[model samples]
Target: MIIRIIDGITEFTGKLCAWTLFAVGFFITFEVLMRYVFNAPTIWVDEISRVLQVWVVYLGAAYVLKHREMVTIDVLLSNPNSVWRRLAETLAIIVLFIFAGTACYFGFQLWLKATMAGHTTDTYLAPPKMITHAPVWVGSALLMLQGAAQLYRVWAEPLPSDDVMGGAH
Candidate 1:
Protein backbone atom coordinates (compact mmCIF):
# COMPACT_ATOMS: atom_id res chain seq x y z
CA MET A 1 0.00 0.00 0.00
CA ILE A 2 2.74 2.41 1.03
CA ILE A 3 4.80 1.44 -2.00
CA ARG A 4 1.91 2.16 -4.28
CA ILE A 5 1.38 5.58 -2.77
CA ILE A 6 5.02 6.45 -3.10
CA ASP A 7 5.12 5.22 -6.63
CA GLY A 8 2.14 7.32 -7.60
CA ILE A 9 3.56 10.43 -5.98
CA THR A 10 6.94 9.88 -7.59
CA GLU A 11 5.47 9.37 -11.01
CA PHE A 12 3.28 12.44 -10.69
CA THR A 13 6.22 14.55 -9.65
CA GLY A 14 8.30 13.28 -12.55
CA LYS A 15 5.60 14.15 -15.04
CA LEU A 16 5.19 17.57 -13.48
CA CYS A 17 8.91 18.20 -13.83
CA ALA A 18 8.95 17.05 -17.43
CA TRP A 19 6.06 19.31 -18.30
CA THR A 20 7.83 22.21 -16.68
CA LEU A 21 10.90 21.53 -18.80
CA PHE A 22 8.82 21.49 -21.94
CA ALA A 23 7.12 24.74 -21.00
CA VAL A 24 10.45 26.42 -20.38
CA GLY A 25 11.80 25.27 -23.69
CA PHE A 26 8.73 26.40 -25.54
CA PHE A 27 8.73 29.88 -24.00
CA ILE A 28 12.43 30.42 -24.63
CA THR A 29 12.18 29.34 -28.22
CA PHE A 30 9.22 31.57 -28.78
CA GLU A 31 11.02 34.48 -27.18
CA VAL A 32 14.06 33.99 -29.44
CA LEU A 33 11.98 33.89 -32.57
CA MET A 34 9.89 36.88 -31.56
CA ARG A 35 13.00 38.93 -30.80
CA TYR A 36 14.88 38.03 -33.96
CA VAL A 37 12.06 38.06 -36.52
CA PHE A 38 9.58 40.56 -35.15
CA ASN A 39 12.08 43.20 -34.04
CA ALA A 40 10.10 43.50 -30.78
CA PRO A 41 11.40 41.53 -27.80
CA THR A 42 8.99 40.42 -25.15
CA ILE A 43 9.16 42.47 -22.05
CA TRP A 44 8.04 39.66 -19.82
CA VAL A 45 9.53 36.67 -21.59
CA ASP A 46 12.85 36.89 -19.76
CA GLU A 47 11.16 37.04 -16.39
CA ILE A 48 8.84 34.20 -17.29
CA SER A 49 11.68 32.05 -18.55
CA ARG A 50 13.73 32.80 -15.45
CA VAL A 51 10.87 31.75 -13.25
CA LEU A 52 10.29 28.58 -15.25
CA GLN A 53 13.97 27.66 -15.08
CA VAL A 54 13.94 28.03 -11.33
CA TRP A 55 10.87 25.83 -11.01
CA VAL A 56 12.32 23.22 -13.35
CA VAL A 57 15.52 22.99 -11.36
CA TYR A 58 14.24 22.81 -7.77
CA LEU A 59 11.24 20.61 -8.57
CA GLY A 60 13.36 18.30 -10.70
CA ALA A 61 15.85 18.03 -7.87
CA ALA A 62 13.33 16.35 -5.58
CA TYR A 63 12.34 13.87 -8.27
CA VAL A 64 15.97 13.11 -8.95
CA LEU A 65 16.73 12.46 -5.31
CA LYS A 66 13.62 10.33 -4.91
CA HIS A 67 14.91 8.07 -7.69
CA ARG A 68 18.45 8.03 -6.30
CA GLU A 69 19.64 9.17 -9.71
CA MET A 70 21.80 11.95 -8.34
CA VAL A 71 25.39 11.25 -9.27
CA THR A 72 27.82 9.81 -6.76
CA ILE A 73 31.15 8.07 -6.91
CA ASP A 74 29.73 4.57 -6.72
CA VAL A 75 32.80 2.66 -7.90
CA LEU A 76 34.11 2.42 -4.36
CA LEU A 77 30.64 2.07 -2.91
CA SER A 78 29.63 -0.68 -5.31
CA ASN A 79 32.22 -3.03 -3.86
CA PRO A 80 31.53 -6.73 -4.35
CA ASN A 81 31.51 -7.17 -0.58
CA SER A 82 28.12 -6.68 1.03
CA VAL A 83 29.52 -5.10 4.20
CA TRP A 84 31.44 -2.45 2.29
CA ARG A 85 28.48 -1.71 0.04
CA ARG A 86 26.12 -1.32 2.99
CA LEU A 87 28.57 0.95 4.78
CA ALA A 88 28.93 3.12 1.75
CA GLU A 89 25.17 3.36 1.37
CA THR A 90 24.77 4.38 5.00
CA LEU A 91 27.44 7.03 4.71
CA ALA A 92 25.88 8.39 1.57
CA ILE A 93 22.48 8.72 3.23
CA ILE A 94 24.01 10.54 6.19
CA VAL A 95 25.78 12.99 3.92
CA LEU A 96 22.64 13.53 1.90
CA PHE A 97 20.66 14.31 5.03
CA ILE A 98 23.19 16.84 6.21
CA PHE A 99 23.27 18.61 2.88
CA ALA A 100 19.52 18.51 2.32
CA GLY A 101 18.81 19.72 5.84
CA THR A 102 21.11 22.69 5.50
CA ALA A 103 19.69 23.64 2.14
CA CYS A 104 16.12 23.37 3.41
CA TYR A 105 16.89 25.63 6.34
CA PHE A 106 18.33 28.32 4.13
CA GLY A 107 15.72 27.91 1.47
CA PHE A 108 13.01 28.47 4.07
CA GLN A 109 14.75 31.58 5.27
CA LEU A 110 14.93 32.99 1.77
CA TRP A 111 11.31 32.19 1.15
CA LEU A 112 10.30 33.92 4.33
CA LYS A 113 12.31 37.00 3.48
CA ALA A 114 10.82 37.21 0.04
CA THR A 115 7.36 36.84 1.39
CA MET A 116 7.90 39.60 3.91
CA ALA A 117 9.32 41.93 1.32
CA GLY A 118 6.15 41.54 -0.74
CA HIS A 119 8.06 42.32 -3.89
CA THR A 120 7.34 41.67 -7.51
CA THR A 121 9.53 41.54 -10.55
CA ASP A 122 10.17 44.93 -12.15
CA THR A 123 8.58 44.30 -15.50
CA TYR A 124 5.54 45.27 -17.53
CA LEU A 125 3.92 41.97 -16.54
CA ALA A 126 4.71 42.63 -12.88
CA PRO A 127 5.28 39.04 -11.92
CA PRO A 128 5.17 38.53 -8.21
CA LYS A 129 8.51 37.78 -6.64
CA MET A 130 6.59 35.60 -4.25
CA ILE A 131 5.45 33.49 -7.18
CA THR A 132 9.02 33.01 -8.27
CA HIS A 133 10.15 32.28 -4.73
CA ALA A 134 7.20 30.12 -3.76
CA PRO A 135 8.86 27.12 -5.40
CA VAL A 136 11.78 27.37 -3.03
CA TRP A 137 9.54 26.51 -0.13
CA VAL A 138 7.76 23.74 -1.97
CA GLY A 139 10.89 22.24 -3.48
CA SER A 140 13.03 22.49 -0.37
CA ALA A 141 10.27 21.12 1.81
CA LEU A 142 9.69 18.21 -0.56
CA LEU A 143 13.39 17.51 -0.86
CA MET A 144 13.78 17.58 2.90
CA LEU A 145 10.80 15.30 3.38
CA GLN A 146 12.08 12.84 0.79
CA GLY A 147 15.54 12.93 2.35
CA ALA A 148 14.15 12.03 5.77
CA ALA A 149 12.05 9.28 4.27
CA GLN A 150 15.03 7.86 2.42
CA LEU A 151 17.10 7.96 5.58
CA TYR A 152 14.45 6.08 7.47
CA ARG A 153 14.27 3.44 4.77
CA VAL A 154 18.03 3.16 4.79
CA TRP A 155 18.21 2.79 8.54
CA ALA A 156 15.13 0.71 9.35
CA GLU A 157 15.50 -2.05 6.80
CA PRO A 158 17.03 -3.01 3.50
CA LEU A 159 15.27 -1.14 0.74
CA PRO A 160 13.25 -3.32 -1.58
CA SER A 161 15.35 -3.92 -4.68
CA ASP A 162 12.64 -2.43 -6.86
CA ASP A 163 12.56 0.69 -4.69
CA VAL A 164 16.25 1.22 -4.12
CA MET A 165 17.63 0.62 -7.59
CA GLY A 166 14.46 1.86 -9.26
CA GLY A 167 11.95 -0.35 -11.05
CA ALA A 168 14.09 -0.53 -14.15
CA HIS A 169 13.60 -4.25 -14.49
Candidate 2:
Protein backbone atom coordinates (compact mmCIF):
# COMPACT_ATOMS: atom_id res chain seq x y z
CA MET A 1 0.00 0.00 0.00
CA ILE A 2 2.78 2.41 0.88
CA ILE A 3 4.73 1.53 -2.24
CA ARG A 4 1.67 2.09 -4.34
CA ILE A 5 1.17 5.49 -2.78
CA ILE A 6 4.76 6.46 -3.41
CA ASP A 7 4.55 5.20 -6.97
CA GLY A 8 1.37 7.16 -7.53
CA ILE A 9 2.93 10.33 -6.19
CA THR A 10 6.01 9.83 -8.32
CA GLU A 11 3.87 9.26 -11.39
CA PHE A 12 1.81 12.36 -10.72
CA THR A 13 4.88 14.51 -10.22
CA GLY A 14 6.39 13.11 -13.40
CA LYS A 15 3.29 14.09 -15.31
CA LEU A 16 3.44 17.56 -13.86
CA CYS A 17 7.07 17.84 -14.88
CA ALA A 18 6.24 16.65 -18.37
CA TRP A 19 3.65 19.41 -18.71
CA THR A 20 6.31 21.99 -17.91
CA LEU A 21 7.88 21.32 -21.29
CA PHE A 22 4.82 22.83 -22.96
CA ALA A 23 5.01 25.76 -20.58
CA VAL A 24 8.66 26.27 -21.42
CA GLY A 25 7.91 26.24 -25.14
CA PHE A 26 5.05 28.67 -24.70
CA PHE A 27 7.17 31.02 -22.66
CA ILE A 28 9.99 30.98 -25.18
CA THR A 29 7.63 31.52 -28.09
CA PHE A 30 5.87 34.34 -26.32
CA GLU A 31 9.15 35.98 -25.47
CA VAL A 32 10.42 35.68 -29.03
CA LEU A 33 7.20 37.04 -30.53
CA MET A 34 7.09 39.95 -28.15
CA ARG A 35 10.74 40.75 -28.63
CA TYR A 36 10.76 40.59 -32.44
CA VAL A 37 7.32 41.86 -33.23
CA PHE A 38 6.89 44.56 -30.61
CA ASN A 39 10.49 45.18 -29.57
CA ALA A 40 9.30 44.58 -26.02
CA PRO A 41 11.16 41.75 -24.34
CA THR A 42 9.82 40.91 -20.97
CA ILE A 43 12.41 40.62 -18.22
CA TRP A 44 10.59 37.84 -16.42
CA VAL A 45 10.23 35.32 -19.22
CA ASP A 46 13.79 33.97 -19.19
CA GLU A 47 13.97 33.59 -15.43
CA ILE A 48 10.51 32.10 -15.23
CA SER A 49 11.31 29.58 -17.92
CA ARG A 50 14.60 28.74 -16.26
CA VAL A 51 12.86 28.08 -12.96
CA LEU A 52 10.27 25.93 -14.66
CA GLN A 53 13.01 23.94 -16.33
CA VAL A 54 14.75 23.37 -13.03
CA TRP A 55 11.53 22.20 -11.44
CA VAL A 56 10.88 19.81 -14.28
CA VAL A 57 14.37 18.35 -14.13
CA TYR A 58 14.53 17.94 -10.37
CA LEU A 59 11.00 16.62 -9.97
CA GLY A 60 11.47 14.21 -12.82
CA ALA A 61 14.47 12.68 -11.05
CA ALA A 62 12.35 10.95 -8.43
CA TYR A 63 10.09 9.57 -11.10
CA VAL A 64 13.11 8.21 -12.91
CA LEU A 65 14.38 6.59 -9.73
CA LYS A 66 10.97 5.17 -8.91
CA HIS A 67 10.72 3.49 -12.28
CA ARG A 68 14.35 2.36 -12.17
CA GLU A 69 15.00 4.31 -15.36
CA MET A 70 18.06 6.14 -14.13
CA VAL A 71 21.45 5.06 -15.44
CA THR A 72 23.48 2.54 -13.44
CA ILE A 73 26.79 0.87 -14.08
CA ASP A 74 26.08 -2.71 -13.08
CA VAL A 75 28.91 -4.61 -14.71
CA LEU A 76 30.15 -6.00 -11.40
CA LEU A 77 26.68 -7.00 -10.32
CA SER A 78 25.73 -8.68 -13.57
CA ASN A 79 25.83 -12.23 -12.24
CA PRO A 80 22.23 -12.92 -11.33
CA ASN A 81 23.16 -16.11 -9.48
CA SER A 82 25.72 -14.44 -7.27
CA VAL A 83 24.88 -13.73 -3.62
CA TRP A 84 26.87 -10.52 -3.76
CA ARG A 85 24.28 -9.04 -6.11
CA ARG A 86 21.87 -8.35 -3.28
CA LEU A 87 24.60 -6.86 -1.15
CA ALA A 88 25.66 -4.64 -4.00
CA GLU A 89 22.07 -3.56 -4.56
CA THR A 90 21.67 -2.81 -0.87
CA LEU A 91 24.89 -0.83 -0.91
CA ALA A 92 23.69 1.18 -3.83
CA ILE A 93 20.42 1.93 -2.06
CA ILE A 94 22.37 3.03 1.02
CA VAL A 95 24.34 5.45 -1.12
CA LEU A 96 21.12 6.79 -2.61
CA PHE A 97 19.62 7.20 0.84
CA ILE A 98 22.65 9.13 2.04
CA PHE A 99 22.78 11.42 -0.97
CA ALA A 100 19.05 12.07 -1.22
CA GLY A 101 18.67 12.36 2.54
CA THR A 102 21.42 14.95 2.81
CA ALA A 103 20.03 16.89 -0.13
CA CYS A 104 16.58 16.94 1.44
CA TYR A 105 17.91 18.10 4.79
CA PHE A 106 20.03 20.90 3.40
CA GLY A 107 17.59 21.91 0.72
CA PHE A 108 14.88 22.39 3.33
CA GLN A 109 17.27 24.46 5.42
CA LEU A 110 18.08 26.64 2.42
CA TRP A 111 14.41 27.07 1.62
CA LEU A 112 13.59 27.98 5.18
CA LYS A 113 16.43 30.47 5.37
CA ALA A 114 15.38 32.14 2.15
CA THR A 115 11.77 32.30 3.25
CA MET A 116 12.64 33.75 6.64
CA ALA A 117 15.11 36.21 5.18
CA GLY A 118 12.57 37.47 2.67
CA HIS A 119 15.04 36.87 -0.10
CA THR A 120 13.98 37.76 -3.61
CA THR A 121 15.58 37.92 -6.96
CA ASP A 122 17.01 41.25 -8.08
CA THR A 123 15.10 41.02 -11.33
CA TYR A 124 12.00 43.07 -12.02
CA LEU A 125 9.83 40.09 -11.09
CA ALA A 126 11.59 39.96 -7.74
CA PRO A 127 9.99 36.65 -6.93
CA PRO A 128 10.74 35.21 -3.52
CA LYS A 129 13.71 32.84 -3.40
CA MET A 130 11.43 30.21 -1.97
CA ILE A 131 9.84 29.99 -5.37
CA THR A 132 13.16 28.75 -6.67
CA HIS A 133 14.30 26.75 -3.65
CA ALA A 134 11.02 24.99 -2.93
CA PRO A 135 11.46 22.62 -5.81
CA VAL A 136 14.88 21.48 -4.63
CA TRP A 137 13.58 20.73 -1.17
CA VAL A 138 10.41 19.09 -2.39
CA GLY A 139 12.14 17.07 -5.07
CA SER A 140 14.86 15.87 -2.74
CA ALA A 141 12.28 14.92 -0.15
CA LEU A 142 10.40 12.96 -2.73
CA LEU A 143 13.59 11.26 -3.83
CA MET A 144 14.33 10.30 -0.26
CA LEU A 145 10.86 8.90 0.17
CA GLN A 146 11.22 6.93 -3.02
CA GLY A 147 14.58 5.67 -1.87
CA ALA A 148 13.06 4.51 1.37
CA ALA A 149 10.42 2.68 -0.59
CA GLN A 150 13.08 1.04 -2.72
CA LEU A 151 15.02 0.02 0.35
CA TYR A 152 11.95 -1.50 1.87
CA ARG A 153 11.35 -3.50 -1.25
CA VAL A 154 14.94 -4.65 -1.32
CA TRP A 155 14.89 -5.95 2.23
CA ALA A 156 11.30 -6.96 2.89
CA GLU A 157 10.01 -8.24 -0.40
CA PRO A 158 11.11 -11.16 -2.45
CA LEU A 159 13.08 -10.10 -5.47
CA PRO A 160 11.81 -10.80 -8.90
CA SER A 161 14.05 -12.85 -11.13
CA ASP A 162 14.33 -10.06 -13.63
CA ASP A 163 15.27 -7.54 -10.95
CA VAL A 164 18.30 -9.50 -9.77
CA MET A 165 20.69 -6.77 -10.82
CA GLY A 166 18.51 -4.00 -9.36
CA GLY A 167 16.93 -3.43 -12.74
CA ALA A 168 14.89 -5.07 -15.43
CA HIS A 169 16.30 -8.19 -16.97
Candidate 3:
Protein backbone atom coordinates (compact mmCIF):
# COMPACT_ATOMS: atom_id res chain seq x y z
CA MET A 1 0.00 0.00 0.00
CA ILE A 2 2.74 2.45 0.97
CA ILE A 3 4.85 1.53 -2.01
CA ARG A 4 1.92 2.02 -4.31
CA ILE A 5 1.29 5.47 -2.91
CA ILE A 6 4.91 6.44 -3.33
CA ASP A 7 4.96 5.08 -6.83
CA GLY A 8 1.89 7.09 -7.70
CA ILE A 9 3.43 10.30 -6.36
CA THR A 10 6.68 9.69 -8.20
CA GLU A 11 4.87 8.93 -11.42
CA PHE A 12 2.80 12.09 -11.20
CA THR A 13 5.83 14.24 -10.45
CA GLY A 14 7.73 12.67 -13.31
CA LYS A 15 4.94 13.52 -15.73
CA LEU A 16 4.85 17.10 -14.49
CA CYS A 17 8.59 17.43 -14.96
CA ALA A 18 8.32 15.98 -18.44
CA TRP A 19 5.76 18.63 -19.31
CA THR A 20 8.04 21.35 -17.96
CA LEU A 21 10.62 20.38 -20.57
CA PHE A 22 8.16 21.47 -23.22
CA ALA A 23 7.66 24.76 -21.43
CA VAL A 24 11.41 25.29 -21.31
CA GLY A 25 11.72 24.67 -25.03
CA PHE A 26 8.80 26.90 -25.83
CA PHE A 27 10.18 29.72 -23.74
CA ILE A 28 13.59 29.51 -25.35
CA THR A 29 12.20 29.35 -28.86
CA PHE A 30 9.81 32.21 -28.20
CA GLU A 31 12.59 34.26 -26.71
CA VAL A 32 14.76 33.69 -29.76
CA LEU A 33 12.05 34.50 -32.24
CA MET A 34 11.06 37.61 -30.35
CA ARG A 35 14.62 38.84 -30.14
CA TYR A 36 15.54 38.23 -33.79
CA VAL A 37 12.30 38.66 -35.66
CA PHE A 38 10.43 41.15 -33.54
CA ASN A 39 13.55 42.92 -32.24
CA ALA A 40 12.19 42.62 -28.71
CA PRO A 41 13.89 40.61 -26.01
CA THR A 42 12.16 39.76 -22.76
CA ILE A 43 14.19 39.92 -19.58
CA TRP A 44 12.42 37.06 -17.83
CA VAL A 45 12.85 34.34 -20.44
CA ASP A 46 16.43 33.31 -19.72
CA GLU A 47 16.13 33.39 -15.95
CA ILE A 48 12.73 31.75 -15.88
CA SER A 49 13.78 29.03 -18.31
CA ARG A 50 16.93 28.35 -16.35
CA VAL A 51 14.92 28.04 -13.17
CA LEU A 52 12.44 25.71 -14.86
CA GLN A 53 15.25 23.53 -16.17
CA VAL A 54 16.75 23.22 -12.71
CA TRP A 55 13.37 22.24 -11.33
CA VAL A 56 12.78 19.70 -14.08
CA VAL A 57 16.10 18.00 -13.42
CA TYR A 58 16.00 18.06 -9.64
CA LEU A 59 12.32 17.21 -9.31
CA GLY A 60 12.72 14.31 -11.70
CA ALA A 61 15.37 12.69 -9.48
CA ALA A 62 12.88 10.94 -7.23
CA TYR A 63 11.11 9.53 -10.28
CA VAL A 64 14.39 8.25 -11.61
CA LEU A 65 15.27 6.61 -8.30
CA LYS A 66 11.81 5.16 -7.81
CA HIS A 67 11.90 3.61 -11.27
CA ARG A 68 15.49 2.39 -10.84
CA GLU A 69 16.34 4.12 -14.07
CA MET A 70 19.59 5.63 -12.90
CA VAL A 71 22.85 4.35 -14.34
CA THR A 72 24.37 1.30 -12.67
CA ILE A 73 27.11 -1.18 -13.39
CA ASP A 74 25.03 -4.36 -13.20
CA VAL A 75 27.47 -6.80 -14.80
CA LEU A 76 28.28 -8.48 -11.50
CA LEU A 77 24.81 -8.39 -9.96
CA SER A 78 23.11 -10.22 -12.76
CA ASN A 79 22.08 -13.10 -10.57
CA PRO A 80 19.31 -12.05 -8.20
CA ASN A 81 19.75 -15.01 -5.87
CA SER A 82 23.46 -14.54 -5.38
CA VAL A 83 24.57 -13.52 -1.89
CA TRP A 84 26.92 -10.97 -3.38
CA ARG A 85 24.07 -9.41 -5.33
CA ARG A 86 21.91 -9.00 -2.22
CA LEU A 87 24.84 -7.59 -0.31
CA ALA A 88 25.65 -5.11 -3.04
CA GLU A 89 22.02 -4.07 -3.34
CA THR A 90 21.72 -3.60 0.41
CA LEU A 91 24.85 -1.49 0.48
CA ALA A 92 23.64 0.63 -2.40
CA ILE A 93 20.29 1.23 -0.70
CA ILE A 94 22.04 2.22 2.51
CA VAL A 95 24.22 4.66 0.61
CA LEU A 96 21.22 6.11 -1.17
CA PHE A 97 19.35 6.54 2.11
CA ILE A 98 22.26 8.32 3.72
CA PHE A 99 22.91 10.57 0.75
CA ALA A 100 19.27 11.49 0.22
CA GLY A 101 18.61 12.07 3.92
CA THR A 102 21.69 14.26 4.28
CA ALA A 103 20.77 16.30 1.25
CA CYS A 104 17.24 16.83 2.58
CA TYR A 105 18.54 17.93 5.96
CA PHE A 106 21.12 20.36 4.60
CA GLY A 107 18.95 21.60 1.80
CA PHE A 108 16.21 22.48 4.26
CA GLN A 109 18.68 24.26 6.48
CA LEU A 110 20.05 26.32 3.61
CA TRP A 111 16.55 27.11 2.44
CA LEU A 112 15.62 28.25 5.92
CA LYS A 113 18.66 30.47 6.12
CA ALA A 114 17.93 31.99 2.76
CA THR A 115 14.34 32.62 3.74
CA MET A 116 15.33 34.23 7.02
CA ALA A 117 17.95 36.38 5.38
CA GLY A 118 15.49 37.49 2.69
CA HIS A 119 17.80 36.41 -0.08
CA THR A 120 16.59 36.96 -3.59
CA THR A 121 18.02 36.58 -7.03
CA ASP A 122 19.88 39.56 -8.48
CA THR A 123 17.58 39.76 -11.45
CA TYR A 124 14.99 42.51 -11.81
CA LEU A 125 12.22 40.04 -11.05
CA ALA A 126 14.02 39.15 -7.82
CA PRO A 127 12.47 35.85 -6.80
CA PRO A 128 13.43 34.49 -3.42
CA LYS A 129 16.34 32.09 -3.32
CA MET A 130 14.37 29.83 -1.04
CA ILE A 131 11.80 29.41 -3.77
CA THR A 132 14.52 28.20 -6.09
CA HIS A 133 15.95 25.83 -3.51
CA ALA A 134 12.54 24.40 -2.65
CA PRO A 135 12.80 21.88 -5.45
CA VAL A 136 16.07 20.55 -4.04
CA TRP A 137 14.53 20.02 -0.65
CA VAL A 138 11.43 18.45 -2.14
CA GLY A 139 13.39 16.15 -4.44
CA SER A 140 15.73 15.06 -1.67
CA ALA A 141 12.84 14.36 0.65
CA LEU A 142 11.06 12.34 -2.02
CA LEU A 143 14.24 10.42 -2.72
CA MET A 144 14.55 9.57 0.95
CA LEU A 145 10.97 8.39 1.10
CA GLN A 146 11.38 6.34 -2.07
CA GLY A 147 14.62 4.87 -0.79
CA ALA A 148 12.91 3.72 2.38
CA ALA A 149 10.15 2.16 0.31
CA GLN A 150 12.67 0.42 -1.90
CA LEU A 151 14.52 -0.91 1.11
CA TYR A 152 11.29 -2.24 2.51
CA ARG A 153 10.41 -3.83 -0.81
CA VAL A 154 13.76 -5.56 -1.18
CA TRP A 155 13.55 -7.00 2.29
CA ALA A 156 9.90 -8.04 2.19
CA GLU A 157 9.47 -9.27 -1.38
CA PRO A 158 11.04 -11.96 -3.45
CA LEU A 159 14.08 -11.00 -5.41
CA PRO A 160 13.71 -10.65 -9.15
CA SER A 161 15.22 -13.13 -11.55
CA ASP A 162 18.03 -12.31 -13.97
CA ASP A 163 15.53 -11.91 -16.79
CA VAL A 164 13.58 -9.23 -14.92
CA MET A 165 14.70 -5.67 -15.38
CA GLY A 166 13.61 -2.38 -13.81
CA GLY A 167 11.00 -4.14 -11.70
CA ALA A 168 9.49 -5.72 -14.81
CA HIS A 169 9.37 -9.42 -15.46
lDDT of 3 by residue, 1-169 (tens): 8889998888899999999999989999999999999999999999998888888887898888777777667687887767787777788988988887888888899999999999999999899998898877888888877877877767777666545455652
Regions of candidate 2 where Cα sits further than 4 Å from its true position: 79-82, 156-169
TM-score of predicted model 2?
0.86
Task: Give the clashing pairs for model 1.
Answer: none
**What tens-digit string does per-residue lDDT give for candidate 1 at 74-104?**
5555542366666666677777667767777
- Which wins on TM-score, candidate 1 or candidate 2? 2
Better of 2 and 3 by TM-score: 3
Task: For candidate 3, list the clashing residue pairs, or say none.
Answer: none
Please give the distance, in angstroms, between residue 27's alpha carbon in candidate 2 and its true position after superposition: 1.0
Q: Cα RMSD (Å) per model? A: 3.9, 3.2, 2.6
Off by over 4 Å in 3: 159-169
**TM-score, per-candidate, Cα-based:** 0.77, 0.86, 0.89
Residue 37 lDDT in candidate 3: 100
Error of 1 at 132 (Å): 2.3
Query: Model 3 — which ten-residue stretch has the worst lDDT?
Result: 160-169
